[model samples]
Target: MPPRPPVPRLAGDGKGEGTVLQVRRLRGGDAGAYQALRLAGLRLHPDAFGSSWEEEADRPLATTAEALEANYVAGCERDGALIGIAGLRRATSVKTRHRGVIWGIYVDPAARGLGVGERLIAAVIEQARGQVEDLLLTVSAHNATAISLYRRFGFEDYGLDHRSLKIGDGYVDELLMKLDLRPA
Candidate 1:
C-alpha cells in the first residue's frame, strides 16, 4: 500500500492570531513527543485513561516509537508543537479485522476549546473511512467532553462496561461506543 498523504491544516477562526491547527499521522520520528504527551495525559487525568502512570512512565522511547510505526496515530500540531493526538488500529484477527479502535485521544489544556480535539478525530475518521467498516472506542463514563465529541462524529453507545478500570480504590465505568462506516 502507498503511504498516506499528510493531513492539511484544518480551518479555524484564528483570524491572524497564528493558532493554526494542523492534523497529521504521527511517524516514527515523533515517538518522543508522543510519549511525553501521552504520559502527561495519563498523569493529569488518571481516571480518563486505562493505563496508569506507573505502568507507562518508565516505558522506553524506542518502544513508543515502534508502537507509532505499528498503529495509525493522528496528531494535532499548533505552530510547531504536538498538542493533541489520537490513534487508531485495525484488528489483526480474521474475525475482527473489520473493526478499528481509536485510542489515547488527548489535547493539552491550553489547546482545548480551539477545535483541536475535533480535528484530531476528523483525521482519524478520514483515515478509517475506507479501511474499516466500524470504528470503536471506550471512554470513561464520566468524561463528558470526550463523549460529546465522539457523538458529534456519529458514534453511538452500544453497551457499558461496569468498573472497566480500577484506579486506586475506585473504579471507572467505560461507555463503549461505535460508529458504523459501512453504507447500506
Candidate 2:
C-alpha cells in the first residue's frame, strides 16, 4: 500500500485562542516523529516514564511502526508538528477485553500549558469510550500536574504501586488511577 498520507491538523478548540492544535490517531507512517518525541520524553523527564531513553533510543523504526499498528496512539500536532501523544490499548484476552490502559502520554515542554496534554487525554478517552469499560493509567507520585489533569477527567486514585520504577538505584512510586466509562 502507498504510504498513508499525512493527516491534516484539525482546528483547535477555541480554548487555545490563536494556537492551532489537532489531535488524531497516529499511523505507522508517523513512526519517525513518534519515536523522536518518545525519546525526547524519556530523556527529558526520565522519572515520568517507565522506559529509559537508553532502552529505546536504538530501537528500529519498524518496531515503532508495528507497535503503532497494534495500539491506539493519539498525537497532538501544532502547525503540522507532532508535539504531544497518548496511547490507549485495550486488553486482548477474552476476560480482560473490557479494560483499556492509557500510556505514553507526553507533551513537548514548549507546548506545555497550552492544553495540548488535555487534548491528548480527551482524544484517548473519546477513542476508548464504548470499547472499554474502564480506562486506567499510572502516573509518578510526584507529578501533581498530571494527577490534577487525570482528576479533572474523573480518574480517581485506586491504589499505589510501590517502587514501580527503579532508575539508577532510586525507586519511584506510582499512583494507579482509573476512570469508569460505563454508566452506572
TM-score per prediction, in order, is: 0.90, 0.90
Error of 2 at 91 (Å): 0.8
What is the clash tally of candidate 2? 0
Model 1, runs deviating above 4 Å: 1-18
lDDT of 2 by residue, 1-184 (tens): 2232222243344586668788899999999999999999999999999899999999999999999988899999988999999999899999999999999999999888778888898899889988998899999999999998888788889999999999999999999998888855
lDDT digits (tens) for residues 121-148 of candidate 1: 8899889988899999999998898898
CA-lDDT, candidates in order: 0.87, 0.89
Model 1 backbone overlap count: 0
Compared to the true structure, candidate 1 yields what TM-score? 0.90
